[model samples]
Target chain A: MIDVVETTLTWRRLSPRMLVIHPFQEVVRAAPALLGLLVAGSSSGGQGHLWSVAGVALMVVLGMLRWFTTTYRITPEHVQVRRGLLTRKVVTVPRDRVRTVDVTSHVLHRVLGLARVEVGTGTSERRHEGRLKLDALTAAEAARLRVELLHRSPAAPATASTVSPTASPTVSPLAPPAGSTPAAETELARMRPEWVRFGPFTMSGLVTVGVVAGFVSRLVSEGNVDLGRVGPVQETWRWFSAMSLPLEIATVVLVLVVFVSVASTLGYVLAFGNFRLTRHAEGTLHVTRGLLTTRAITIEERRLRGVEVSEPLLLRAVRGARLSAVTTGLRAAQGSQRGGSLLLPPAPRAAAVSVARLVLPSVAGASSAWEASPVTADLTAHGPAALRRRFTRAYGVHALVLAALLALWWWAGLPSWTWLTAAALLPLTALLAADRYRSLGHALTSGYLVTRWGSLARRRVALECDGVIGWNIERSFFQRRARLATLTATTAAGKQGYQVRDVDLTEALRLAAAGTPGLLDPFLVEAQHVS
Target chain B: MDTPTLRSPQHRVSRTAVWYWAARAALGWLVLLAAQVAWLVADSDGSALPVTAHVAGLVVTAVVAVAHVTVMPQWRYRVHRWEATSAAVFTQSGWFKQEWRIAPVSRIQTVDSERGPLEQIFRLANVTVTTASAAGPIKVSGLDRDTAQRLVAELTATAQATAGDAT
Candidate 1:
């Protein structure tokens, strides 16, 4: 350990233990090229392996060079990371602006008792997307850093700050948003292995399969491999082609479902095996999850604006749901499923609702006492206009598809069953439309604006009224004709905008006004008018 | 009109907005028109349609482009309106797909104005009122320069006066 005498403000290098893992990581990163070289080496006879060796050496040198060039320092008011060899790069984040602190360690790092720290300032700006990263710090050091970075208040005006040579001192005079609370951390949720039963309902498996299929197809083509020549492939094709139409269709569907379920189960375990959600007394929510590559994320609860309860159609059938935090700083586009915002992985719907309640405890008197629960309160229906629009759009889409299929049957001499199949889908579509109509509702309750919409991915977003920054009222030509509008309450948190889609024009306006009173007053024709 | 009953915003933007919009629309259409001309030249010999057919094709495209360039701006000008009070900023924009956006002055994060070459020639500017939302930044375009400048200055001051991060 070359670092002698630790100063709070001095530039710090990554743990030297990272030197053991970087070369391996570099090789993994460059696997495709190395694999190609190996294949080409055998196919075209020689020297490709030599090129591969040289490439590995170059990658290792690059990896080791990174260790030498990179150094991070915590100034009185900011956290700065300096890296790059020739074109020097420095990323500085005001300490108070720091939103999240993530400490992750892969299998190798875990073995070496080292972790990587990622400080998330949570800005979606293109120039500096993720704040800063310090790779391969000792596990204890990373844990200590995460706490020190998030829980501790930024420098007060009294401290005379020293600027690191690599950094230009741009110290902010602003006070930290939350003073550190010295309360004990409370565990909100822990992953139960039984929750893996919800794995099959998630679409993650299909995504993995699609990616693998694409890669395989590309590899087959690139290598000019004749899959048809493979004995097993030939036998499978023959058997498949010989099957009766209905039997073949059934077989394929059965195989797909089986494969998808298995993949999703694997993914679920890999991602959420040891997931735990805890609230720190110092105003941070900690989520430690992922099996092989463990991650511990620290989020300031003061930045939390709300929580979302999401139920995909399939998951809803099984009473399974997911939960996410609606908070400032994090980019909405990154998605809650894979990041710091994920409050709970797919679990029992009851579990998600409970977690939501825990995350957003309702105000005593302010919360609508009549409702059973604050987060899952009975919402105000969007009325007949929205219902009519739902049915119209639903049948309109079905009519378009049926018409197209019928045209093919009449003009192009296609099978009658093709049109019949399209017609047969009507009942399902009708069911969906009805379900969607049922879900189309919004309510202002419990100091939160809850907008529930969508059938496929039903979301009941409970955003704090205080978090809403603006209002957007959009009426399409059809919506105008129907006298309905989509009111989007835009905020800095979560998805940024949660829409109460296809509500009556007057109703949308009323809801917006109620959510953030007085803003819409001057623009309304009559503040109290509902019709 | 048998439309929904909220009152329209106070201002209809500078009448010069029509000309500015026409120029903006034309700039886009001209490139498409140029591409059509290029493609026609490239394929003319191979397709060898009757001269009348080629002439008709070109004429139809030109007619459509010109009609769009002319009618869109007029429609937009009629629809685009804006109002800014000390309390809130309201804007209505777009022609067929109209959007009505309102951001409280307290929630507003930034007030910026931009002028492009086309806007400069028309003596028009666009005033943008940004909030902390990703779907925010309500813009009132084609304002006369004087109004745009005053609006930016006034909104900036109003936003600063309000407490909290506004989100």
Candidate 2:
């Protein structure tokens, strides 16, 4: 047996782009500081030239320090980096747990024909853990390094089964050397289409959001009013012609609203240009797009934990549904507020369902067979005794708070109609409760745990049981009283915790038991009872 | 699940961490005190503050400083742990909040050792772990040279093991 020892290796030389762009980019970034210094020096007067020369000299020194300080190296054993001028830093990362080699190119770097390569190791606990960025590398060099590291590292065994087309024509990338082809076929049967592309972009909704934001900012800053705002002006003119000055104000308000909406929609379209999605050979979903600054996001297929498709009340009329997926990593720009998934805004429900089917097959079939298990069947079978009792016990205070609101409205000497309006909330509350009940379902099979829930907007989540690196059960003071518990399952996907809330005490325990076998001691009912 | 059998080197945070935390805490307190004093002076009605209010503010400041000095290091220390196995290196740390993390030998995407000024004086370095998390990556600080080297060795061994297993 060969005794192979790990050693640090020097990184290849910095890409030529680094030399070209580093100086200008640094100067631009430090423009404000330089401006502040110039203003201060000029105000001081007597030795302005001296200070200016000194400042220029300082900036040059700092820039050179930054450039010379940065260096990186990768070996079959570990990755090493040395950086910092005043206080040098050398970091080494092992090869085995490295998850991915991410190559990113900003506008400047792209122009310079260079990319920043971030090596990500598979331990996703802390924000900066297992992450190192090498400043610049040529595209070809980066790809070659990535390929070599991937081959050397063992995190992904299946990659070995995939023979590179360039490496051998006889060997199929998907087919292993021997009997693995049959297993690969079965795996393929189970592997649904993992991503959907819209035009040239995978995340068109995000672009739309950016456009909307830009439009709003422009309206606020530049005072550009659209047709809707002009409508009020026209209305006011008509009113003036008709000798109705008092009503002119109403026309102005109406015009402003119309103008804003039209302008915002136009801006949105302009922002989201040529969106598309492409599946990489490595089972990662790559979303690429941008009119000005193009972006490509690679999301691992297994990291996808859940998919949520939503249709708000206004959207239902338009036959539009938004699709979002929740994965392990940090929240993307579009999904930060709602949690998980990308929102494919305003697609037809059929299209949404088709995409859903591709991503999550088990839950995709549930809508059509919604009746096989009546919405109320689980409610009756499990009954309030097991589930509803726990639900009311957990959220019954909300009902009382609504009742108190109605009582206060009545006491305030407002019109009696106010109380009626407040009382109308009871049905809404019940409807929400029923929706929650209907959406809740769990199935464990095929090395995965599939959980489904949601009301108007439905969600189906599938997680590999083995991939679950940590599990925690939490209960508040009130939760203890209600015998309800929340179970959080954490994987390598960053800190956006996935949870099942207000589950029946017994059911939660059972699910946790099924999901985390040896991780938690078996037959630990005492621990379960505390919650 | 069967626990994989492996051997690892015992590792601890470099002594530099204590001084680092202490200095950081002191600086933070100074900044906080300065900010609070500025706020109080700005918001005060034209008249000078009463003795009671002055005393109360002093007491709060004292309490905050004490808490900062005493709590910061413990919190820092508890949030990180590292071990080097025969095959790979593993580090896991998060306070009462637990994030069970493991970096196998073969799949380590990158390994890097970093040192700031204080760490240089103490001959210490920090190691970072990166995965595909959008929030970015995770890092562990305060490792000595010997421990870092051993970790690199273990990681290489484990990576080789994985490669062997796959083949």
Every candidate's DockQ is: 0.50, 0.05
- Alpha-carbon local distance difference test for all models: 0.80, 0.50
Cα RMSD, each candidate = 5.3, 12.8
Off by over 4 Å in 1: A1-6, A29-41, A45-64, A122-130, A153-183, A221-224, A333-337, A367-372, A399-420, A527-531, B1-5, B45-63
Q: Write the per-residue lDDT of candidate 1 for residues B14-123, one digit (tens) a residue.
A: 99999988888888878877876777787777565665676677788789889988899898988899999999899898887888998888888778899999899999
lDDT value, candidate 2, whole model? 0.50
> Candidate 2 lDDT, tens digit per residue, A196-282?
222222233445556556655544332323434568768966656784555666665665555554554443344333444444444
Rate residue B138 of model 1 by lDDT: 95
Instruction: Give per-residue CA lDDT, model 1, range A152-262, as digits (tens).
Output: 544432332332332223432222322243246688999998999999898689988997787656445444455788799999999999999999999999999999999
Error of 1 at B146 (Å): 1.8
CAPRI class assigned to model 1? medium
How many collisions between residues are there in candidate 2?
60
Q: List the residue pairs that clash in candidate 1.
A: none
